[model samples]
Target: MPLILFNKPFQVLCQFSPQEGRQSLADYLSIPGIYPAGRLDADSEGLMLLTDDGALQHKIAHPDHKEAKTYLVQVDGIPDAASLARLQAPIDLGDFVTKPCRAVRIAEPEWLWPRNPPIRTRADKPTGWIAITLEEGKNRQVRRMTAAVGLPTLRLVRSSIGPFSLATHPLMPGEFVEIPVAALKSKR
Candidate 1:
C-alpha cells in the first residue's frame, strides 16, 4: 500500500471529485484508488495524507484514534494570553465543543510558502501566528475556535498529522511524495 503526503494549495477542494470552478485533489493527483484520509478545507492549505489502505485511512481520520494534527494559523490580531489560553482549553462552538489542545504563539514559519492569492491585510491591525494541535478535527474547527477568541483566521495551514510533518518532508504546493507505511511509527 502506498501512503502519499501531498502539499495541498489554498482554495483547492479536499475531494478528488470535480467541483466546477475549483481545483481538487484530482487536479494534482492521478493515482488510482488513493483517497484522502482526512480533509482540509478549501480555504486552508498544506499537508494532506492520502492512502489506498482502508484501515490506515480509518486510523488517521477517525476521532477515536486520537491522532494529533497541527496547524500554523494566522489570525487578524495578536492573541493575548487569555485568548491563547482559551484556544488551549476546550470551547463550545455550538455544533460541538472542541477538546483541550495545545496552542501557543509562534513566529511565522520561515518554511511557509506564500498563498497564490495572498490573504487580505490591514495596515493598522497587526496579525499573529499560532501553532495549534488537536486530536479531533471537525468542520472549520480551528477557524471557529480562533473566531471565538475574537481573532478571525486570515490563513490556515496544516503542518502535520500524526507522525508526518511538512518540516521533515518538505514539498511545494501541488507536490506529493510516497513513503512506506512503516514510517508512521516514527516519532511525531
Candidate 2:
C-alpha cells in the first residue's frame, strides 16, 4: 500500500483538482492515483493522509471506523471549567449532536510551525490553546463546537490521526513522508 502523510498548510484546498484562485493538493503532490483519505477545509491546516488504495482510504476516513483524530486549536478566549466540560460532552450542533470526546486545555506546542499570514491578535482579548480528539468528523465541527461554547477558534491544526502523529513523524507545511503499510498494524 502506498500511504503518504502530509502536513497541509493553511488556505490550501484539500482536493487534487485545480481551483481557479486557490492552491490545491495538485500544487504540492504530483504522485498520481493517490487521493486524500479525508479533507481539511481551506482555512484549516494539519496532517492529512493520502492513499492509492480505496479500502485503506475508507478505513482511515470513514466515520464508522472510529479512528481518533486530534486537533490543536487556538481560540479567542480562555475556556473555564464549564466550557471545557461542555466541549467533552455530547452537544447539539443543530444539524447533529457530537459524540463525547476528549477536550483539554494545553499550552501552545513548542514544535508548531508558524502559519503564513498569521492569525489576528488583539490587545483587548485573550487567546488559549486546546487539544481536542474526536472520533467522528463533521464539516467545520471544531469551529462550531468552540463557537457554541463562546470561544471562537482562530487557528485549527489537526496534529494527529490514529497512530500517525506529527510529533513522531514531523513534516513542515507541504512536506510529506511515506511510511510502510506495516506501520498501520497497531490499528488492527
- Estimate the TM-score of every prediction: 0.97, 0.98
Clashes of 1: 0
RMSD (Cα, Å) of model 2: 0.9
TM-score (C-alpha) between model 1 and the true structure: 0.97
Where does candidate 2 have its weakest 10-residue lDDT segment? 179-188
Off by over 4 Å in 2: none
What is the C-alpha lDDT profile of model 1 across 1-188, one tens digit per residue?
Answer: 89999999999999988989999999999999999999999999999999999998999899999999999999999988999999999899998899999999999999899888988887999999999999999999999999999999999999999988999999999999999757655543
The models' CA-based lDDT, in order, is 0.94, 0.94
User: Could you tell me the lDDT of residue 41 within candidate 2?
Assistant: 93
For candidate 1, the 10 contiguous residues with the lowest summed lDDT are: 179-188
| Clash pairs (backbone) in predicted model 1 | none
Clashes of each: 0, 0
Off by over 4 Å in 1: 185-188
Using TM-score as the measure, which candidate wins? Answer: 2
